[model samples]
Target: MIAVDQHPLGRRGTVVANNAGLVVMVKELADGDRAVSLTNETGSTATISTTADALGIANRGPYRLKDPWTKVPSTNTTGTISASVPSHATVVHRTAPGPAPLPP
Candidate 1:
């Protein structure tokens, strides 16, 4: 599952975590950082933090937060997070399991 923000930032990684307030490009990623690439409703994709707040950085994982499906990423600005991040928690954010089979 992935969350996509409907905003354009150059032409890089389109996939993004709507729950994340920041976006990233696939080319510039550090080792051990999990990123989810999402294409928004507008067809633009960006990389988003899969971890909750700073916890993603501390734990070396993607920034994962509450249910992102509940809301969409704000195109106006970086959405403010009402919740706080707890100490020492890591969540895995990766491509969904399995591959899409070609049409026979």
Candidate 2:
């Protein structure tokens, strides 16, 4: 997890890549208090208010030619979310295969 306080305009947070080769970023708003924008490798972005209980996500993609997707918290005003490539996008879902099983 990463944290920022009073970030500067156009200031983007660190980029973290998981084993799946997806790049993740957190951009803080210079004007708003504790407001941040989270962007995935596909350029999808989500803006959330740290103070208030609000969250929004906009899916932007060149990977998958599909409608954008958005999600908001149901119960709590604020919550955490994890995003991966859209199903339509071509992604490797299975892990590397081990050596072929020996004949029974």
Candidate 3:
């Protein structure tokens, strides 16, 4: 895909979560943003979650998340990044750092 090919997560990637049919990974982009990928391969829906600290994002706090497929933009203030993902689907988010928000 054009998007995937264009934006690549550098070599410093971390697998934040993983299991039989689900996987979550994150990496810091060249510009200091982040790429968080949540994948579901089973026959049921799944809720994937992780913290920015786990994602290796050491920024202050709040972060902006944008899903490439849906073009929906969201935010994270508690360092928690989560999503309700459908079966056999993958949600890739491009998160940009924002001003620090309150703690979790």
Candidate 4:
């Protein structure tokens, strides 16, 4: 994870990439707002959140996969902060499999 602290005003923070062809960008707004953006290599960007306090926000991105998703070059922002699947990406919940019965 890339940690950016005290980033300059009007400047973006750190950027990270994953094997899934996704790029994540962290931005520090001039008005003390923090935001996170996820973009594919194709240049499609999805903004996660823009809030003064990152701790209070529960930002969720659209990217979801059946396989495990890993973030390359782990990232973290100090001051405050918070997508890439798609504009229609929505939350998905999977039910757990039940235990098999013992043979009679």
Candidate 5:
């Protein structure tokens, strides 16, 4: 909670999706990046999704996602930002436009 609030990308949030047990919020950063929040309000796990257009991000290239809480890295190349969130849990990600690095 503190880490998310204190992170620079975690400000200026705008709710993009809120329904079906999934709530999503987006924050545009100054460095051409985005902070996206996926919250699951259901008793069971849920899959939440949003688009780059919905996130107000103009660029359409591949994007990289890093979890502020977990420090886990992922990628999105489908213009869609989706996540499988645990019940009543919130997953926050930092999205930046770029290609994912090759895995060795």
Candidate 6:
């Protein structure tokens, strides 16, 4: 679970993709630190706005917001998110079949 702090700009909110490919954002943030977003899938952008939060998500309470949508998980997915700058992007290796047994 991720936590978000309320921005100084009157607790505005924005949906953003985290390193784990989750869609999350802060909703109805308080005057101080608070959480406001959550993601449900990969390869999707988090919607950030000053409006009445996102369509599917709603402010559950005075200092919290939640997504009313359900999420489904996938099997063929594995990756990591990083804010650190790298020299270049490269493929470390490719998938391969297991080795076959030798003759007896």
Best by lDDT: 5
Q: Give candidate 4's total backbone clashes.
A: 3
- Model 3 lDDT per residue over 1-104, tens place: 24543656535557878888889987667666778888998899999877788777656567788876676786555577888999999878877776555788
lDDT of each: 0.29, 0.28, 0.75, 0.34, 0.78, 0.29
Worst 10 residues of 5 by lDDT: 1-10
lDDT of 5 by residue, 23-50 (tens): 9998777677778999999999988988
Report per-prediction Cα RMSD to one decimal: 16.0, 17.5, 4.1, 16.7, 5.8, 19.6
Report the lDDT tens digits of candidate 2 across residue range 1-104: 12233334656544333333343333334433222222324344322111122211222111111111222221222233233444223221101111233566
**Best-performing candidate as measured by TM-score:** 5
- State the TM-score for model 4: 0.30
lDDT of 4 at 27: 52
Model 6 residue 13 CA deviation (Å) reads: 1.7
All candidates: TM-score: 0.19, 0.29, 0.75, 0.30, 0.78, 0.22
Residue pair clashes in candidate 4? 1-74, 1-75, 2-75
Per-residue error at 27 for model 3, in Å? 2.8
Q: What is the lDDT of residue 99 in candidate 2?
A: 29
Q: How far does residue 45 in candidate 3 sit from its true spot (Å)?
A: 0.5
Model 2: residues with Cα > 4 Å off, grouped in runs? 1-8, 32-78, 87-104
Residue-wise C-alpha lDDT for candidate 1, range 53-103, written one tens digit per residue: 332333222233233344433222122222222222222223211122356
Model 6, span 10-55: residue lDDT tens: 6455454344544345434333333333333434343322212232
TM-score of 1: 0.19
**How many steric overlaps does candidate 6 have?**
12
Q: How far does residue 40 in candidate 5 sit from its true spot (Å)?
A: 0.5
In candidate 4, what are the lDDT values of residues 12-91, reduced to their tens digit? 44554343445455454443333355444543445343222332223322212111123232333222223234543421
Please report how far candidate 1 places residue 42 from its true position, in Å.
Answer: 25
Name the lDDT value of residue 75 in candidate 3: 55
